[model samples]
Target chain A: MNSVAQTFSTAALQRNPAWAQLLGLCPLLAVSSTLINAIGLALASTFVVIGSNVCISALRRIIPDAARLPCFVLIIATFTTMTTLVLEAFAYTLYIKIALFVQIIVTNCMILGRAEVFASKQNITATFFDALGTACGFTLALVSLGVVREILAYGTLLAGAHTLFGPTANNWTIQLMDQGLLPLAAYAPGAFLVAGLLFACVRTLRSFKKIPPPKSQSLIQD
Target chain B: MADLALLLIGALLVNNFVLAQFLGLCPFMGITKGYDTALATGIATTFVLSFSALCAHLLYHGILAPLGLEYLRIILFIVVIAGVVQLVKYYLQATSPVLHQLLGIYLPLITSNCAVLGVALLAINANLNTLETLIFSLGASGGFTGVMVLFGAIREVIDHDDVPAAFRGTPLALVTAGLMSLAFMGFQGLAG
Candidate 1:
């Protein structure tokens, strides 16, 4: 039980897939322009990560070491497809906006990295907690970036929640300003800048506390 | 001809896969420390990207769409891409040892590069024909290589500069990329 709790917190805060490890930046940067899109993608990715992690953990013993990567890709792709179809059927509007990014989640490296590093070796119970924690960390990153970008670009929070939550959320938008302070925050350039600054801020804060960096294994080999 | 030319130019500049569209960022950030390796990886990526895009287009149009198996695209495209990367690896190993040594390490990495899959899916989504898909893939990958080479050159310069501890490695690189992206945004009107 203690180990499970440790795994959860470690994945969520210490070794965050986004900020610290830099596992899945493609979707992180692309779909984070709006709060609705970010939430939509985050939910979809969370579903994929947990689904694939559990399945891979359950079947890890049977999967051949030589063919593990192909097997992992297949499982991730299946869950990604399921997420794509479900979103298309229910949230067609939001789905259209982020369809490409959603489909490419199979290649996000974060999911595949977890499968290769954690799920393939651990049992289903540990894998489940790890997946959950990683998903939460990814969600935190995406939502924070979404909130920051949405506020800077559109001057509103949850501006289009209706697309995800249906007609009731039409008024969920909270207008923070009459006009967006920095329209550039809505585009690709703004994504890199904001993400860079965010990383720098986190590093600065960590340095202030003089916390030694965690010895987390990097998911990507470069 | 005019439209294809416009598509090429648009993809190469206005909708660059790396700087502007935010695809293939893993490799964009990962293997960009040295100029020689970066350029080699870019060239290798360009080759695999165009090949996989062509194969994906044919597979989708010839097989999946006809059979109403379009929903299987995400799975099929990835599998096909992985296969293509393997084929390229072997063909390189057998044919030109020198070229293989230069690019072999990067070939496998291309299988997971989102930009390759992005081009395939984007072409299918835009309903481009075979020729257009080929051209678009070339343009997109060309843009990828161009930006990668440029970023690599810039990184070489950045290494000597006195960057702060908090922003030394990836953060600094990202800021440089943001500046490059800003510069690329100026090409927006050129395509329009």
Candidate 2:
């Protein structure tokens, strides 16, 4: 949002896709139990988003106007298959941990949303940046949840570093608490609590800076 | 009867769609801004999600798996959902203009909803027979409706309350959902 270019606001970027925009929450709380899992999911999702957006943007003109939505799904499925194949082949360890959610990425509105909104209209370069920005926003949210879950659940940061960063990061974990305390914080309700706290931290920072929060807009009427 | 009852209660309360399973969140946050629309959207989504789950299950297990086209399930499911949404739209246009108006853009958005796919995936994961999958999908959708309506109603009440500044919107909803999740957790041991 700070660039000389004004593509999209960071606030717009960082609005909770799960908690705020309500776009992709299934994996947000579910796969976030560990940093490595969350990071792997984020990478796979980002790859799909970017690949789909770019293809949709490039093909917008040549595609029959009527088949736009169907074409977009085909594009997304192709990219998803590509990402899925790579995950299944090389990163089977992380892949197994996240396979279902990886496939679920095909269902994420965030990907189809850009396909419908930006990529369907804009050029590839702009769509590329847009996906990167949105994925960064999503990654920011994922990593926050990951940090909270890893700390509360496992008493350490990067507790399963080998799964994500490979053996090189086996030394990166930092244990901050003793074992077997605050068991509830490691569970589902805890995911909700940590997400709430993270939202508060962002809101507090936004308020102190005096930025206006985006008010709810009703696009459809009953 | 007992197993069916357990599945119904487990989905409807213990594993309430919004708070615990985290399904259909877009509608949960969007429709909750008002009471009536939330109720309408919830009902509409329940109809679509339940049906989509059924179709996805039939296609996934009955056709795709048999042909070893499981890799194509996502696209196939989306295709089925899109077709279903259009059919529903046409049917609504023919019969209930008021309800059609109420559904608005959300009808097509249903195809993109993760809940439908989540239900589909859960159906395939459990590898349930047709009867069980239908019951589970319907139960999950029904539970989704119940939770969306409840959350929307509670959120309407919370919106008027004097919440702290930092806890104003999504944060507060999430916290309320967390508490609701805790409440739902109470239903855990009841089913088994």
Predicted structure with the largest TM-score when compared to the true one:
1
TM-score of 2: 0.89
TM-score of each: 0.97, 0.89
**Per-candidate DockQ versus the true complex?**
0.71, 0.51
Candidate 1 lDDT, A1-222, residue by residue in tens:
999999998888787888878878999999999989999999999999999999999999999998899999999999999999999999999999999999999998889988999999999999999999999999999999999999999899998898999999989999999989899999999999998988898889878877667666645342
CAPRI band of model 1?
Answer: medium
TM-score of B-chain for each predicted structure, in order: 0.98, 0.92
Instruction: Write the residue-wise lDDT of candidate 1 on B1-192 in tens digits.
Output: 999999999989999998888899999998888889889999999889999999999999999999999999999999999999989889999999999999988888898899999999999999999999999999999999999899988899997889788898888988889999999999998875
The C-alpha stretches of model 1 lying farther than 4 A from their native spots are: A209-211, A214-222
Which pairs in model 1 have colliding backbones? none
Tens digit of lDDT per residue, candidate 2, span A63-158? Answer: 898778778887897888788888888778888877778877887877777787678999887888777777777777888888777877778777
- Candidate 1 lDDT at B34 equals 83
